[model samples]
Target chain A: MEALVASAVAVMTAVGVYLILRRQTFPVVLGMAMLSYAVNVFLFATGRLVVNMPPVLSDTATGYTDPLPQALVLTAIVISFAMTAVVVLLALGSFIASGNDGIDLGEDRE
Target chain B: MNHWIIAPVVLPALLAPLLVLLARNDLRAQRMLSGAGTVGFAVLAAVLLVQASAGGIGVYRLGDWPAPFGIVLVADRLATLMLALTAALALAVLVHVISTGWDARGRHFHALYQFQLMGLAGAFLTGDAFNLFVFFEVLLIASYGLMIHGGGRARLRAGVQYVVMNLAGSVLFLFALGTIYAVTGTLNMADLALKAAAVPAAEAGLLRVGGVLLLMVFAIKAALVPLQFWLPATYASAPGPVAALFAILTKVGVYAILRMVTLVFGAGSPAGDIAGALLLPAAGVTLMLGMIGVLGARDLGRMAAFAVIGSVGTLMLGVAIFTPAATGAALFYLIHSTLVAGAMFLVADLVRGQRGGLLLAPGPRMANHGMLAALFFVVAIGVAGMPPLPGFLGKLLILDAARSAPTAWAIWAAILVGSLLAVAGLARAGAAIFWATNDDASPVPSQPLALAGVAGLLVALAALTVAAGPVSGWLNATAEALYAPAPYIAAVLGGGAP
Candidate 1:
């Protein structure tokens, strides 16, 4: 199971990086979303793989997965969404203002 | 749980909507209300400092839940110090903005400014890693609005780039935080410190990999060299108070790195020498590169931005070296840099107003007033780490700590070269603007507003530097607490020996 999860992570990271390198704003935005999800899932797995146990506290079970990771990942997910929304707006705003939405928004520093 | 830990987080957020409603009719009423709210925040910050001191680690669980299960707002000495500084800077900006009459009550500016303060306070006081991200976004949102205020073309262009760059950084930041979560299974910084340190040897490398990724993202924000390109341009073009405000934002990134490094990856932890070595070189390079930039820049705004960069380099040098004195230097320099950079930005705004900014094409009213030019000259010298200033004292501590190291000579050389070059550059700018024969003075309007604020800040800086003994004593305590992470970890982890 650990091997399977790790493999999935590797694939996701590769795809995300490739998309991030693309020369268009929309693809880059999509890449960020994919990358954020893969990251959150991967981080949740770092506490070590656990099965049939959720992070929620219950009376019967001795313990579930680590709750700290859960709390953090949840917040990361929410903030990432906010970030995604902002980036999309910026890309749209750039397009409306400049009539071009290339991938290199401000990569060159002068 | 003392509410002090969390009130600053919620107050502006809750009060902003209220302000939008209350001040809709009366502009004077809005200014009064906003000023009162800011004062209230500063007072609450004081209470939180006291609570943090007594409780040792004030963790107020949001929604009445226990640690690692609910949202947490933690305030230790470190967090309290950051909170206190943030509050103080905001208050100072408030004074400057009001006295200068930079803006009237039109255009929802006061509300957004209030929200920005709240976000900064939240970022400082929040305990959980994810909450930190939330606060960062909160701050960024407010910042976007603040940057484009008054609708100047240059401001609009820079604001667009600034937002996009930070948005990208935010994405990477979340990804890094997520990576940490995947490995540690805990987001609470305290819990992660303990758990991450205890990971099995087989898995430690991967965990360290994640940690380094997170560190890199912060390094970018902290404007560590090789990742510090966006800073000067964006900061140079920003509005006066907004640029001053950004001085603290970079430190927030640096503070997060210092805290994360000391608490999450310090000695006796799974994170090893490789991590320390990785960061140490970046510090030296950042210092050198910043000096080079300062040497080459022609414009006043851009030059001040490089000075801010140079200050950050000094800070990174202290933290990366990882000694008691070095860490203390880092902490002290952090405070000094934020204040000095802030004051310099204010100076830039004033100088630019008279000369009409840094375009080579001369404005009709090209620096008719000598007062502001002289004032900025002294400030530029002070910020260059020249004699009898806070920056000089801060650099001395860094050099003292680095004296015995192999890289000591290089850092010393960089510090000297950087300061001297900046002095030459800014003095040239001063000579051209202030001392040159006035062929076409045009009688520039008096820039009394920013000049007064800069003058006050410079005097305060002089006092701090001159009285370095007692100030250094207080700073030494801050330094000791920062480098030695055992106590901090012990407090949050509930009595286990770190």
Candidate 2:
């Protein structure tokens, strides 16, 4: 389970970086989404992999997984979701305004 | 559990939505509410400053939960000082926006402005690392709205770049937090401090990577070299008052570095030496390159943008030395630079308004050209660190404090040469805009209140200069407190020293 999660994160991160390096705004937005997904998974695993265990202190529970990372992961997901929406809207705004979605705008506009 | 520690964050959070809902279409109502709210916010900041100055770290835990468990907002001297600075700058920018009617150019300017202040205050006041990230996002989102408020193609394009870059930085921040939380098993800053100090040598490398990653995140915010490519475009394209308010944004980065260094990685921590060792050289190079950019800039906005980067470089150099006296000097300079950079941006906007653009080329003699010229002169002198302004005194203090560092000569040389380049840049711009004017073009009338807004900032700078003695004394105490973090740790963690 740990290997599966870690490898998934690594592959997603690599693909995200590649897309982020592209010239257009759409790929960059997609890249950001991919990166956020990878980070969400990575943040979730920060508490270590524990399965079938209660996150809270229960009398009958044999053990517990760290609940804090679950909480942190939720916050990360919401924030990244909001940020991705913002970036996508921004990309769309720029694309409509300028008729181009190239990431680089070259030099300062006078 | 003093409640006032949370007021800075709460006041703006509540007021922002009210402005949007109640005063949506009424500019006068929005202005009155925002102006009064900002004045009230400044008063709250002053109260907090006084409270912090009384030498107790006020920690406000959320939901009445205990330390290292629930999130906390801790107001120390450094945080309050930043709060006070933000309030002052916000008040000035608000006045400028109102007088010049920049807010009407876009929707919900008042709401966005309030949220920006909330985020800044929260970021300064939060003691939990993850909470800091949340505040950072809040501020960044507000800034994105404000950035392209008076939307244009260029601005939207710049805003896109800015948003994308910050999203990447946010990702880096999460990665760093994940690594640190994995190692220390805690995200509370005070707990991280204790855990960081006791991390085994085998895991020290991981901790160090986390520290460096965090540094890079802050560095991106600070516009430190190599990562500074986004600033010129973003700041230059932002609306004037928004740019002025953004003067505090970079300082937010510097403030985080100070907190991270002194509180979390101080003295015997595994990542203790990372900031000082890496920040110094980067700051030096940043200073030189920034000033060179200033010299090459053809427009006032970009010039001011580069000047801001240069100021941050100088401020960080003082911080990178890692001594109490140096930190004190840096704090003094931090206040000075934030005010002056804000004034410079406002002045740039005024020049753009009167001369029909911000391009540093000959134009017709503007209305009140003499006064505008004089205002430009004062701001230029301040930016170039000339005598009689706070910038000169701040730089002097930084240089004096840095004399004991092993790389004192390099520090001195970078600052001196950077000042020279800044002077040349400002002088060139001033001459082109104010001196070499054409008589063929009609004079544009300058707005009195807008000019007064710029002067208000200068007056604040003058106040900083006049109160330098008392301010430096206070900052010295603040620095001393930072270097000795036991009281802070004890205050946050609820009993005896860690």
Candidate 3:
């Protein structure tokens, strides 16, 4: 399970980096969404992967998974969602105004 | 009461729901929200100041769970001071937003602004590493909306770049956090501080890698050079109040550096050892490059943005040197920079609005009233680190501290050169804006209320500078506590973990 998640993270990171390096906007946004998910999982994993155990105490379970990572990831997930929304808004807004979502407006002299 | 513990967060959170409910029905509801937000700022500022004055740093736990487990808020003197600064600036900008009567402050605008404040306040207050990222996103989202509020082509274009850069940093930040967590199994800052200090020498290099990566993420946001290109473009083109709000965001990034360095990654830790060495050169080079940008920049707003980059470099100069006096100077500079940067951006907005375009645009009619131009000049002087201003005094502290280092002579030279370049840049821009009577003059007197507010802000900043002696003493004590580690460690850990 850890290996699978690691491989997924690797692929996602590669794709995201490639997209980020591009000049256009939409691909970058797509890349960001992918990267954020990868990051969330990666961060969650660092609390050290656990299975069949949740952070919340159930009295039935002998011990719970680390509560710290659970808290961290949950907050990261929400914030990433917010970040992605803002990026999309920016992309659409840019597309509407200048008709290009390229990296920069080529020096912003105006 | 504990009720006050959540007022900063609660007020803003409550507004979002109320705003949704009022989406279609009442414009008055939106206006009321702006007012409510100002009140929230006032209350939050008062709370932070009173707490700081008492030399008490309060921690609050949700569901009453203690720290290193439940989410924790540690309002140390530094945190409270920062929170107060954020609140005061937000309140001033909020008032400017309401009284100025721009077309953008509609149903969505006020709520977003409120959320942005909540994010900032949260970032200022939260003591844990994980929650800091959460707050960053909240502010970033609201910032995107605020930046493109008017639907201008250029603003949208600039805003996209801004979003992309911050997103990149956000990704890096999380990855860094994961690596740190993987190594230590700790996300709480206080916990990390204790654990990070105790990491064995064999894994020291591995740990430092994660630590430096974390600093890189923050440096990008603070607009340290090479990473800073996105800022001037985005900030210069952003709407007035939005730019004003952003003034605090980068400082938050700087605050993260301070928070991390002095507590979580101090000396004897691998991260601290490596980061200290690297930050020094970065500080010097960043200052040089930033000065060049300021000199070459054409637009008033963008020049101000570059100047901001230089100011960051100055603050880092002291910190990178890493003595108590040096770090204290850095803290002073951080506080001073936030105010001066906010004021500079507000002046840009005032200039742009009056002239109906960029300040340096050819044959542009300067519509700013004479008194307004003088006000802008005063703020510009503050940013330039002119005497009797907090900016100058902050730099004085930094130079005084940095002068004692082995690298003292070089640091001293870099600071002096940076200050000169900053003054020259602002002076050049000021001459073009105020002295060079435009071919077409359109000096618009600001609305009375807005003028009054700007005047009040200027006066307050000046007062702060004039009262610098006592404030410096207060800041020194705060800086002492920040450096000593024992008080902070004892408070959070109950001193049990050795």
Q: Note the chain A TM-score of all models in turn.
A: 0.86, 0.96, 0.86
Q: Which pairs, if any, clash in model 2?
A: none
lDDT of 2 by residue, B134-191 (tens): 9999999999999989888999999999999999999999999999999999989988
lDDT of 2 at B150: 83
RMSD of each: 3.6, 1.6, 2.8
Interface RMSD of candidate 2, in Å, is 1.2
Instruction: List the candidate numbers ranked by lDDT, top first.
Output: 2, 3, 1
Question: Which regions of candidate 1 deviate over 4 angstroms?
Answer: A1-12, A22-24, A40-74, A98-110, B24-27, B47-57, B99-106, B152-154, B360-368, B442-444, B495-498
Best candidate (score: DockQ): 2
User: Between the candidate structures 2 and 3, which one is better when assessed by lDDT?
Assistant: 2
User: Per-residue lDDT for B71 in model 1?
Assistant: 60
Q: List residue ranges in candidate 3 displaced over 4 A.
A: A1-5, A50-71, A107-109, B1-3, B23-29, B103-107, B361-368, B443-446, B495-498
Candidate 2 Cα misplacement greater than 4 A, ranges: B441-443, B495-498
Would you estimate the TM-scores of all the predictions? 0.88, 0.98, 0.93
DockQ comparisons of all candidates to the true complex? 0.32, 0.81, 0.73
lDDT of 1 by residue, B1-498 (tens): 566677887778877787788786666776787788888888888887777555476667677666665566768777887787777677667766665566562377778888898888888877678778788888888888777666554555555666656766776776677666666767777778778888888777877777777787788778888778778877876777778878888888887887787768776667575546777778777877776676677676777788778778878877778777887776777777787888888877765666666532334444436666666766776777776667777888888988876788777877777677777766666665566544666556674554656766776677777777876776677667766666665555453221
For the second chain, the TM-scores of the candidates in order are: 0.92, 0.98, 0.94
1 versus 3: better TM-score goes to: 3
Worst 10 residues of 1 chain A by lDDT: A101-110
